[model samples]
Target: MSLTSTEKCAAAEELIAGGKLEDAEFLLEQVLDSHPLNVTALNAKCGLLMRSGKMAEAKRLLQIASDIAPEDPVVLTNLANVALLENRIGDAIDSLEQAHGARPDYLAAILLLGQVHQMLGQRKEAAEWLTRASALQAEDPDVLAAGAAFELDQQNIVEARRLYEKAVETRPDHIRSLAGLARIRCLAGDFDKAVELAKKAHLLAPQDPESALVLAQVFFQSGALGDADKLIGRFKRRYADYAPIVLLGAEIRIAQGEVQQGLADVAAWFRKAPGDAARLVAFLKLLGKAGDWQRILDMCEKLPAEVRASDAVVSLQEEALLALGRTKEGWQSWARRRNLSGESPCPPVQVTLPPRAPLLDEMVLMRFVDAVARNGRLEVSGETQIPGMWERLSAAASVDWAREAAPDPQLLADLAARATLHAPENGGFRAYLAPEPGRRAMWEAALPSDGRPRVGVFWDARPPGLLIDHLQDALQDLNIHIISLQFDESRHQLRTWRGVLDAGVKLEGPGDLVNLVDCLDLVVGPDGVPLHVAGALGRRGIALLQENHEWYWAGSDRQSIWYPDVERIVLPIGPSWAGAKPALRETLERIVPALHLPVTT
Candidate 1:
């Protein structure tokens, strides 16, 4: 009944596939002890060691396997795996390339190369490799799923969905295809179908880490907290701390108001084994939530050299350093953001936004300060009213601003290929954008009676990073008249305001906003377009920076080089808005009384 070394190695592969690492290890050892140079035995043993978290041992054994069969593609790929585990990205890539070179048609090497190239932001190489893989194994469900996953990561949802559909049709039992489709559904907000797909994936691989994590996330986000909790309990210790399951458990707990305990759990997990990208992002956000800037900085030092350079971590660090008075280092760190790879899914499209990039109108407004720049025309088409300074910007930036709800994609592509786009981060310097005379006159007619200083408030209702839900409560006890300067989709939330004039509805564009801001005693909001506009116009304002902050307003001594006149208030860690209210009152008491002027004539 005894098995040969080859037979034992075959059985060991089955055990590893079943997640029975100990049994797999025993079988591999028996074969390895007799046939020390057996490649199959060594490869299977490496797999078992890696699964058991013995990366060093796995790597050492792989070196021996390489010597035994120097050109073996499988051994070369395992070498890549070990390098990846240690975060040695360059070495991993070299190994993969060598494997592919040795055997260009090696399907395993091709698929892995496609995945790794995508992870490293090598989109051209990834596309090439993926195309090759598809050509080689067009009907294989696994190949179809891998292609879909790569496309999904690049945010090509339609292409990914098409591939996933083909994959499921080819083989409905493929676990990865099911899970990939589930995630796409979740992103599309079809939570019911997402739950169904995730459940099928989990049922197919009840003990698999990825399947469990995906199901748990779908359940949690869809408000099936009880199911998520039970799933977490089932796999809590079965998966390691570095797996996203740990972060998922802590996230569920934090969402339920167990902030302290949830933070502690993540802290311990990150301290022990810290370099998974998703885990690091969540951990750093929680650290900021707890106001632990020093530890966040400390994490930068403790991280693997490759991970420390990630755009996400570095961006967050820039914000932390700015908040901590390390201006020199913060800006230097932030400057690196413009070119970092592998972090962003793709580079910003190269082109001039004539109507210009709408969301970045504030940045564009700053660039229009130069007289020579004002000589161009910008053509833009949109459903909403033309933004303030539309005509002026075309004159300033050489753009022709237009009005169209739907623009032709071909026209945009042609314009972008040759258009000159402008950026406002010009050495932190800017010229003031003056309010249009007519809009200023209209705003003057709507000014409040002279007495209790009028302050325009813009707490974004969408709450990307700032949301003070109790704006009414904060203003109900103050002496100031709160004008609703909020705009866009967030303007509708002002219906509940008592005795407030909804002036946000009146804004025509950035120029209109400038006119309103120019007339107010003070403008108050989180760091946003309004605050950015206020600073550009040399107006007084209070900018509330919460735990999750952007580096756009990075300046030392609570001053932004871009908005030096505005009072910068960094909200202390913790999600509560209790601290912001006090700062608001103090800034108003000190500044509003010093200037009692009427709306600008």
Candidate 2:
């Protein structure tokens, strides 16, 4: 007569929430042993399994629970959770809708529906669903916290602060609300108040990792890297199994310039929990940051098929392949770049973009805009959010950016069809862009008549200063004239050098730059605009790829398929540029000799 099965099940749910998984399993088993088909016991056990990185097993239990009670709100909600854990986002929404239909007053399903819609960037729908939930349960702290989180994600600070304030008033001990309010204060640049609120939350629940994480993040953001590191170290000892704590600690260490240690921590976490999508994503991202693309590809091949095929992992794998010069395969997988960033709008739940097309991709839309302008007049049916972009486009071309409030289905369809940039073998036109006639004439007049080779040097974006220094040194001694086409602060480096003309000093735009590139025998460095312009014009050039080279330069070892006239010199990845000297010399010997002007290595 100690307790009924229902009471035990309820106790088990509390245990699961408290991180007492072993005790929860014991209680669930006791209830299940007495009643094998008990949905509550099954759901409770499944939650424990899922928390421990056993998604497949948890799904089996959830399926059994669902079969027994098809219309049970908890069962359907748990089913949605299982789908979410496995990255089946569409299936998750379907289950959530079913859960809400089964029990119209179920708060969890309503909040989850709102959360999922927001994750997909469907703000209007998310607001409507969250509004319904808030209207029904105004006093519930959970409901208020959910509303606050959605507002905070979109930077609606006023609304978010109000909701967080209300939630905190309802339950002062609520760690999530406290942490959220602290974040809002931090975003407002009120560091002192952020620290006070976070510290209060941490003191109330010392074991709660969310409180600790918010405090550490606040410290990190406030330029207190040392304090953040110390706090993270303290939290890591007690909350080693907590995913957010581990990730946040690693992030703090990285901010402190302890990147090697941070990478080790994330890599170790992945080794221990490869099933965790967040761990995999963190590991790959850190590896990329360290310019270790080779290691990423190696790790991907070793992982289990399920883990390898994860949306996050696959995106990184494609990036690694592209960085390592695997072009054809990378471009074949290029349409999935939208999935490269798996956005998690909510904590502990991975929300990803759908792999299908017709999403509002501004990058592709811009490309279309550019193409339309070059050809004739353009019609921009959909609205754009980029400041001053439409005005600029309208200035350049006869564009109508004043029609529909949202993107037409036709615009999305066009974006989907024209996503790929690769020129299919024997089909699409490969070279069409050319320099403006007047600008090209100006650059031609600016060139010297000394009969020496014209070399245009530009190191934009990730400027390898030392590498460019060495390259220019070798070129100056040779029978060639150097022209500095670098328009940014990097152009200052060439000021002291004598007899070097500055063509990019006051250029108007890319058109002027393209004309400068047209005058040079070679245009060099990690520049996207100049390189593509030179390639389109069938110009010969030497490309110095960056630590993380873009996908267009993929699968190119000796020469580019996109521009066979240009040769690729893949610069070594990482901070040190010393190793690239010998590689650069070899490329110079191979390509420069053909310039036919008495070149000696």
Candidate 3:
């Protein structure tokens, strides 16, 4: 018996549900050939075309179906899908809303509307639609997965995990649910479980790049570099022009110790995406690390003015200038850069009278005077000399005191203006100081008669934690008596190194810093207050730096303008501190011989 048109349409729907897309397409075409206005046949054919990735043909058929059955919810929903694929978000929303109006219980349309709103970043509207869909079909795996995706986007990770788990339980082989779970696991630092779930998703849908990418990232984070490298290699071959894959490939190369090649890959990305400011900054940092001062300067010049004036860019520029031996130009550039921050200028205020006793306020006022004098603006009118302040400040600023008058009100105002212009945000007011007589006396009285060279060491900064013990171990092998200049909360870290080396002496407080710094043969540490103090005191020092160090340690050169007596050694990029051991050893080897010290080992 021959089937009727309606029966053929129902049979085609069944074929589609049974995964026989070709058979369904043939039956729908036969029906449509006879009944050109048949909504069911048109909708079915549109869905089949969509499933085959023929979006243009699917859109044409969906339009025909909508025209034939103006009130058909299924037809509207299919039309919405076509609109969405064409990037017509408003059209998609209108179609989905019309579908819901046509048949209020249309679960597919409700779910799609929710997903569309989510994609548009309308979180509140998306939640409303998703809540309605969930109420309508509480046990639907698709609904559960969609809800999980919303939760994930909102960063409600716990709820997302629960929803995804329920989805996978409902439909054990759901690829999206598995992938979602894998992503959550990866973020939670459970790489082992993340890899397992990601592998399962990849196995189920081998062509899906998301699952493969997730698996590769899991391997990378878990320190399985070989696995990540292999997977990334395959992805590069298969998805050669994929941007995310290319970026990950570059990172993987860097992790594998191909620093220059990896940097070149990043540079290629920068060339392709010139307008990405973050990427440009990252590229400049890599150039700085490679000691490519010319390239750093050239790239900074190419940047937009606003970007070029940014703190990171200006810092790199400063480094490049100083490295190129343009010290005067670099200092002037730094002064100008400091003035660009748009902060209100400091008010010209009169200096307050010094406190009768040697109080903290008096010391602060004295330091302020010292800063004023260093700027070459001090005009002392009276013979009330503040001990060593005038001579120290004048010497540090490289100005001759004989050419200038003593400190006065006008001089104080000029100092205030220059201080406001040149003072760093951290208040690093390059004030000159003679060693405190009292602290010097105590230190001299306690000095051991053995006459071993004293090296001052401090390690740690505000962020970017370092392996201080490794540094100490390297230093301990140098046959020198070490002195701990570490203070503040980080001094607690010293306990770990004490037993491994000779019990080195330590500074008692901040007061001892001046005398102690003046006492040391050399200071070595991460760029911080100790190094700054050593530099100010004219002591030779070595600064261990990460790749993206602060602006003060500008340039790739061994020397700094802020600390002319100090040299810098920068660690490799990517695994910066992790790769510092060899660099530190090599630098210390050169430095020890240059210092004319006997090598113990």
Candidate 4:
């Protein structure tokens, strides 16, 4: 039935309040058709547009309302809300200031302004407003909830948990407080605690899309994939209009290796929520992983001009272009990533061919130095480590004989110092020593009076980024007592070491690590816990290094600055990309002779 203008406006406000935004927008459009200057209808329409996520249209409607009633606190607050949604954080702060100035005790504007500052990475500014809001209303659930979010962002997990618990105590049905607590517990590896909080949140806000999303994430993280799938299905059926549930369900399906099925599932979500930037980027990344570059290119062509120009879409487009071997276009687009606005341009690395020779000479080293000077820094195997730095200098010396410079002892010492103390590139930087009380006493008891070569043996520990299968083979040949510093049941693998050295020892977590360092004759591992601990303790150890790992292990060459008493067993790479397998027989044959070499004066 056609209604009067006043009746239509009231009906729109009722629908908006009920969260039926589509219905509200429809009614507002009909009412605004005749009474174009109806500020109340316009304000309600702006809010409906916001709920629908049509931020541009929301801003337009709010602007019209502001034009009609320029000084209205309500209209100004609505404008600020739209600005916050669009991430115009500074503008949101200004708009909120104006709105609150007109209405001094406006709680909503003050709270949202604080949240905007928090999102902008202005932690101090956010805390100020949040503190003010809390002072104004100590028991307000929303104020307490925002404060908890601020604390969580700062990584003060203890304070965040306390604040969230207080928020829930004050308002038992506060969904934000419940979800925040659940997320923190999940991060701390307490899945059981997280599940309990999530269940409570789901019960309180049964119809809220965010609650269902949080529950699904908690279930997924806890390895209850089936329960997550069921919750997603139930949420979809109940809140068929909700788009986030469908998107999250698709994400879960992708994680579970049902990529094709997940794509089909999210098609409806894309239809309902067109131009979802995050979803579109995620879909492209999935396609890239599956080697579907052609399909990604098709999507790029079909995307709207504005969406294509978006930072996420543009970065994806560039990646697709590069992967498709469009090198010229790819490099041209790469210019966008470079800070070319600076006064001086950064030069590219100069490559000097090494005449396909067996031995790299002083001239070759000179060319390597020139290349490093040109490029600003040398990268070791595409990683910014010292070995990479030396290799580039080696390359520069290859071209120009005059550029060659012998190793400067002082410079070498400084580089080694920096690499030991500051280089976290390969998790090798360990400047601080751990104090091991019990282990140190145990080691003191076992210490030989004559000081026959002390060797520390760490057998069953896997270092980060090592292939576990490879470490097992390497362990069999080394003649050393196996000490297990692993937190898990890898001690069974100590059979090989036991066969060689005839002794086995087990060390617990950090404590065992500290004690093991005190008693070892020489520490040996395929670069595991003992390696870092021994290095930090300034102990002598032999590092069995993987071929490509020399850069990360020793910083430069096969010598370590962190542990001066250490010798590296490196598998030197030859011409081809084939494995750098060391001749173990030859290595063992030379080890005794090399160790017997008189200390170079």
Candidate 5:
């Protein structure tokens, strides 16, 4: 007994609704044979195939559905979905645009189009579409939440909070909206509000790791590590079956300086779930620190072929091997990684220098400059993108030589032409210090001729939080009458210090900060505005860098060519917690002993 086309289609729909996907596909094919242009059957089958991860089949059915009903919104939206899933971003945009044009008030089409634009990095257009979508569906909690998240990502906290608040008002239990609000509050240093929202999110979605993670971040920010520890334990217990959450917990623990315990937990989790690539990469980097090189090499050997092929992991493997002195194999691995790093856009450098190295002469430095101009690409250096060969070479040379060669006019022209600069601080040259007054009285009053050596202290800068304790320790050991040029003196700030260095030390505000920097015999601090001021004032100082040399300092050696008067104390390349802190203390100990004056005591 053969069924009619309509009957077969209805049967397929029933089968699909009943969760019998294979049966639905079979029935749908039978129906399609009798009625090849059936839009309803085609659209339904397209949706089914898409849900089942059959992208090609879904696209074909969606195309057929579109051809059958040229003006149909549903068919066009499905086509757009298929295109987006296939990563045909431009095609997805076109299809969604047409769909939106056909049905101008279609909220889903507008939202999908906006998402595609956002993913393609067209945030401006995405925002426009999102705004229109919000107007069309003003009460949509998801739309409002997405808008809030985008604004938050843009660092517009006030706008993001407003949108997030609206989303919560519309649907109070919306997890994403709650999480967005919590993140914004956390960023704004309102940990109490952040904690409240995060707790509400966790209550709403008991099994969600995201809410728990947000809570952990808030706790970490507020220095409530014990609370974070307890919440993370709850998170692990609840989501013990998942791998990423466990790895994330380990990362948080390590961040709080429980390195051994964190590493052990991470290793245990990796043994259970070896298939997760991100976690695998993270653990490999961690092992690259102090773990047995043979163990890391063994792990590399057992890595899945696909993971081994990943450039990031491959580079890590090579660098680790090189650091461990497996030079021959390491070079081979490096060759592979160099290829994986892709071709350089800049020309090749072939300049040579004499074998004898010393304080760089003008001729040697010019050869360096010519080689760079010929070969190296100009880039913006910061705490992330370390300067390239040209900038690095310049940063390592004498300031007098570099100034003569790379003058403001030539450097500015080059930077403008190339859309980059040799050094980030070259243009404008805005030194943070007010120029010292010409009058002799200001100078005489500012500089104390005390035989005790008017030692200065500045214990403030932006860093990864751990370094602050190290800074405090270094300050404590100096045992001098130190004055703080403290910037973040407010109680509400994230990086607050409560007389950690010493109770006898005087904490100065912005005005006193400047005055004290003017008066001090020797200034010392991390990379902060005061450091810059001290350098410009020709005051000898030391910079305690949190990261390695290549990170932000931009030179291979400890001495800074940028600020020749200011010596640099960098954390060593190898991962020892004792390195940066102890090195600073020793440097301080050595210098303090040389001050031929009596101790304050």
Candidate 6:
């Protein structure tokens, strides 16, 4: 039997919903041919075009439908969808808003508007639209779940939890609501509940990557490496091209000591999305950890000029050059750290110091020098005997102790242009300051002769986040003599480890801190002044880093340009230090073997 135009349009929608796009398109075209002004047929044809990835044709059909029925909410909403697909965000927003204005209670338009606002990073507007949608459809599971997801994005945890719970209550098997709740629980460190919720969501939709990702993250963060690995393997098989899954898998593999495999995974991810700066930096870091200096330099050189000149890329390049023992090239690259604004120009100034005067004011002068010194134009009067002076001096300009020259017009012009003029580029800067004879003699005399390794320890950095007690307890079993290099607020932690420390070493009022640090076999501590001092004095050290560390600790590379001999042990991302314990233990084990100390315990 033949069907009427309206009947054919209805049949087309059923066909489209049943996944028969070709049949639906043919039916919709016949309906539109007979009834060109039929908004329903026009909208259906636009949906079919969109589903088939013919965005331009979809938009044209949507426009025709909108013209035929200017006040039709469905036609307006479909047009907005077409606009969004085309990346015309502003047009999508305008269309959606107009649809909502035409029919204030249209739940679909309200929901779409909420999503579009969220996509534009307008969370407040998204919340308003979502709230209105919820009001319009009080029992809609999708609306409740979307509202909960929006709350989660805004970090309104308590409200998000409430909304997600309500959504689950309304529809027990809502996958997104369950996943939303699971994410909150995971972030709150309630891994057990998070696992339970995520598992339930995964069971409901086993192939859903979002649910699986949440579950995998919960497992990894809870230290269930085996479960996380299994989940990651499944995800890789199911969604091989998924970037987050690939990155997470790489991290898990690296943490499991499959360094080469993990590195390969990271490189593969970068190849897939080469323009992602964060991932590119991550790949370069993995290459560095593998000690592939040649590859690091080569990969860096091959990067687009803009990417190569970025701060992160430049920093990695500097580290690779320094690691390869190319000091001059490394220093030249390191000078790129100066991010200058062209608006203001400051002329290079050579501060002349009277004899018997301090070379530069330690407190105020260093800050200014660090900010303005470029290319080597900021010259000092002469070399000073001050113990910590050389380190700061080298950062600005190389000292010409014997042949002093006046600051010329060329130097001033270079400084005015904010050119790289740091003196370290001259290749003659000393790594450590020359300590006074008396201070050096005192430190040498106080050196420990106990056949055991002398390890310097500093347990604090102003905003404290160190595992001091745990570190002290762990060190108690090692056969090494501890020297406390702590000063200022760090001195308080000394009482906590006094029982295990040797009483012969005098830490109180020890003058010339650099000379003292230079005498130690190795320094180990969190990011702090003592670590910096050790690095400056050309001493070997171990730096304990938190996940959110200073910019100097760029990438996963253990090497630092400021402290070439220092190795970094970065803690995993989390609120607690539990994840870091294993890495710390492994580092200590490596250090003991390198120091030629027998494994005592």
Q: Candidate 1 lDDT, tens digit per residue, 304-387?
A: 878888877887787687656565566455444543221211122212333323344434333432322343333444322234
Task: Summarize candidate 4's per-residue lDDT along 69-151 as a digit string, tens digits.
Answer: 98777788888776544434456678889988998777778788788778656788888888789889978887888888888
**By TM-score, is 1 or 6 better?**
1
* Candidate 2 structure quality by residue, lDDT tens digits, 1-601: 6889999999987766555677888988898888989988998888788666566778788889889998898888888876664445677889889989888989989999998888666889999988889889877887898889997987667888898899888777677788899999898768889999988877765544557789988887776767887887876775455556677777666544456887889778777756666557777877775557889889888988987887778888877766676644554564454433222111111111112222223422343344434445544444333323234332244444544433322243233223233223212224434566786788798787577778776663222223346556556565677787776555776755667787778766555665677787877655355665666567777777644555446444667755566677765543345445667666766766566555644
TM per prediction: 0.59, 0.52, 0.44, 0.45, 0.50, 0.42
Of models 3 and 6, which has the larger lDDT?
3
The regions of model 3 sitting more than 4 angstroms off are 1-201, 263-341, 344-426, 429-556, 559-567, 571-599
Regions of model 5 farther than 4 Å from truth: 1-136, 169-174, 229-247, 258-449, 460-479, 490-518, 535-538, 545-550, 554-557, 560-563, 570-582, 593-601
Which is the leading candidate under TM-score? 1
* Whole-structure CA lDDT of model 3: 0.66
> Which candidate model has the greater TM-score, 2 or 3?
2
Alpha-carbon shift of residue 298 in model 2 (angstroms): 6.5
Candidate 4 — which residues are off by over 4 angstroms?
1-57, 60-70, 119-124, 153-155, 195-438, 441-483, 488-509, 517-532, 539-554, 557-601
C-alpha root-mean-square deviation, each candidate: 9.5, 11.9, 14.3, 15.2, 13.4, 14.3
User: Residue by residue across 88-126, what tens digits does model 3's lDDT show?
Assistant: 567778989999998999999999999988876789999
Best by the lDDT measure: 1
| Worst 10-residue lDDT window, candidate 3 | 354-363
Clash number by candidate, in order: 20, 2, 6, 23, 0, 8
Where is model 6 poorest over a 10-residue stretch in terms of lDDT?
408-417
Please provide the root mean square deviation of candidate 5 (C-alpha atoms, Å).
13.4
The residue pairs found clashing in candidate 2 are: 325-555, 327-555
lDDT of 5 by residue, 40-82 (tens): 7897788677645566777787877877797787688888777
